[model samples]
Target: MDEDSDAQVMLRVAAGDRKAFALLFDRYHASVARFAYRFVGDRARAEELTQDIFVKLYRNAKAYKPTAQFKTFLFRVATNHCLNEVRRGEYRVTRSTSSPADEDEKGVEAVDAQAERPDEAVAGRELERAVGEALQGMSERERAAFTMCRFEGMAYRDIATALEASEAAVKSLIHRATLAVARKVEALQAGIGPERSRA
Candidate 1:
């Protein structure tokens, strides 16, 4: 279903059709749910928030404008909803994703990083933990920037559009986030408190 462009589905959805909404939901629900769970750990809350966003999409479909990329619009909706609900204490803050699939992914990345020395598995897990802790400590905007720009490999311009910030501001934010995360990882590796490191 992802093969279908969001704009095309959105156009149909905007015309008082439910099939388009169904297709969009099926196409996006997993990713949105995963993203929500990554941003907020509670499974129930993530499901609730993801559903609410889709509902909002349906209710607001008539106002859809195709001028912007659909991703930016969708994420903007998710981000704003997550931030607002977070502020309202409706969801629990969580670490980065830690699914069974993610464990397999680390195994794959590890294979690529050092397939010759598989004994580094423990060290790799430790490093992954350090990174996850660092990500967990970031502000929502910083997390969003770090996740979208680095983890998701989005361009700075796209990130700026998704985040609704100037490109320079987005760049600075990502730079700062990366630096903070690196410092945290270094502190963890060195067995030192993160407070003593550059942030």
Candidate 2:
């Protein structure tokens, strides 16, 4: 459904409509799970976190105002929960050791479908690993912004709202994070370690 429709469903959820809540949950569950997975880097923990996020959304539905896109509101909730959990040391974020085929099965991250050649597939895997390493090294805010912007395809303004930061600040976070990831990926491609690449 479109954002307007999602907003209307959320309003119904706020008014105690069970079906509406279910519908919203069905619509966004996978994406939220993917977001959580990216944050925690573990499928099982990400699933648990996704469930908690939805429960929190249901409980706080009354506080939701349709001032922005429904996604912005939803992700704001997700972002806060993830950052809080990380800050509290509830779970440490680590790179997933799952192979490309495993990630494809779980829909966590997709290997390029066009990468049929062995070398192309290897390059894709290297790039994915480098990006994951870069994300693990980032500050929470930078990681959040970069994931939303690059992976979730969120716009800068939407990310700013979700992050409760100014657009300029979101842009800055994304820039630094993206640059780091890019450098790491480039280093991998150049047959160098990221630290040496930085040097």
Candidate achieving the largest TM-score: 2
TM-scores of the models, in the order given = 0.75, 0.87
Predicted structure with the largest lDDT when compared to the true one: 2
Candidate-wise lDDT, in order: 0.69, 0.81
- Per-residue CA lDDT of candidate 2, range 1-199, in tens? 5899999999999999999999999999988888887777788888999999999999999999887788889999999999887887767667557767755644324224346889976666666666677877888899889888877778999999999999999999999998888778779868985446546
- Model 1 lDDT tens row, 1-199: 3323888789799998899899889887876775666567677778998999998888888777887666666777877777777777756565444664564442322112242455565555555555656666778788777777765556788778878899998888888878776777678568674445434
- Which residue pairs clash within candidate 2? none
lDDT of 1 at 87: 74
Against the true structure, candidate 2 reaches a TM-score of 0.87
After superposition, candidate 2 runs with Cα above 4 Å error: 105-113, 193-199
Candidate 2's clash total is 0
Worst 10 residues of 1 by lDDT: 106-115
